[model samples]
Target: MIHIRKSGRDDASGLAAIWRDSVLATHDFLSRDDFIEIEKLVCEQYLPKAEIWIAVEDGRPVGFMGMTESHIDSLFIAPDQHGKGIGRQMIAHARALAGILTVDVNEQNVQAVRFYRHMGFVETGRSPTDDQGRPYPLVHMRLGEQRPTDD
Candidate 1:
């Protein structure tokens, strides 16, 4: 059975690998150089943050989610694990911890946008560019109407 648990310092490498592979599979919109830069930040800075969780299946890590307060900063599952409901389980875990979950998904990623929608997240707004001012747009979404953020 798959389980969600707090990530440890030792999980950084595994999580980075999952993030890299998952992004390469689903985020084709990203430029090659952009993907490289993002991976560096993820390995060197982001995964060190404590509010992260991992999905373990049969003694191996397959996915992870990074959060801050109620916002899901990132969520990625190994490409091979895509259809196994791991992402749904991860989001449920986040909701349990934060009450409600918010996420910013790449607007160009139709699958991710649809996935979040089916998971009960609704779009609140859109940004012309990502947080770093990259040309990639973000679709901001939140779960239902609980504690909504004014868009």
Candidate 2:
């Protein structure tokens, strides 16, 4: 059975792998050089500094989320695990811990935008460029007061 748990020092590589695979699958808008640069940053910097929660199954990490207080810095599910309710579970976990949850989804990723909306997150703002000042836009969303059932 899959479960959510706090990440450990050893889980960094696995989480990074999940991030790479998920990005390759969902972030098709990223250029090759951009992807490489981001991958290095995610592995070498972000993963080490962020507070993370991981979705583990059979002793391995299948997905991971990086969070800061009530804000979700990043959420990535393994490409093979998409549509399997892992993301939903992670979001629920985050909400329980943080009370109010927030996330920034890439505007180019229609799937992610739709998923967040389905999870009861409403868009609050937008940024023309990502944190790195890239051309990719971001849709900032926050969870509503009423939680939606996973239908």
Candidate 3:
């Protein structure tokens, strides 16, 4: 079973590697220069600012997610760890913590778009260019509000 927990500075390196590897596996459309720049920013800047969470399997770090009050800034899994439900676990935690989950995913990433839609997030908006102003398009999604359950 995968365990989920808050991350600290010590987990930075592992998180960075997962980010790099995941992007490499799925974001092949990005140019080498853009990819390197994004990798640098994610490792050196964004990861530390976001409320980071790690998913560990067999005592090893396998996936992570970063969120803020209004957005899920990042979510990545070790390439070897895909199809293992780690992403679903992380998204469940994000929904509980953030209350509302909003995420921007590259439109070219069909698997990710399908995954988010499957998780109850619907496309609320779109941008012609990604956050970095690159040619890649972005699909913005938001989860539908949940109804309260009786006690």
**Ranked candidates (TM-score, high to low):** 2, 1, 3
Please provide TM-scores, in order, for all candidate models, with all chains considered together: 0.93, 0.95, 0.92
lDDT of 1: 0.90
Q: Which ranges of candidate 1 are over 4 A from the true structure?
A: 145-151
**How does model 1 score by TM-score?**
0.93
Q: What does candidate 1's lDDT look like per residue over 108-148, in tens digits?
A: 88889999998899999999999899999999999954555
What overall lDDT goes with each candidate model?
0.90, 0.93, 0.89
In the range 72-148, model 2's lDDT, one tens digit per residue, is 99999999999999999999999999988999999999999999999889999999999999999999999958946
Query: Could you say which candidate leads in lDDT?
Result: 2
What count of clashes does model 3 give?
Answer: 0
Clash counts per candidate, in order, are 0, 0, 0
Minimal lDDT window, size 10, model 2: 142-151
Residue 129 local lDDT, model 2: 97
Regions of candidate 2 where Cα sits further than 4 Å from its true position: 147-151
Q: Candidate 2 deviates by what RMSD?
A: 1.8
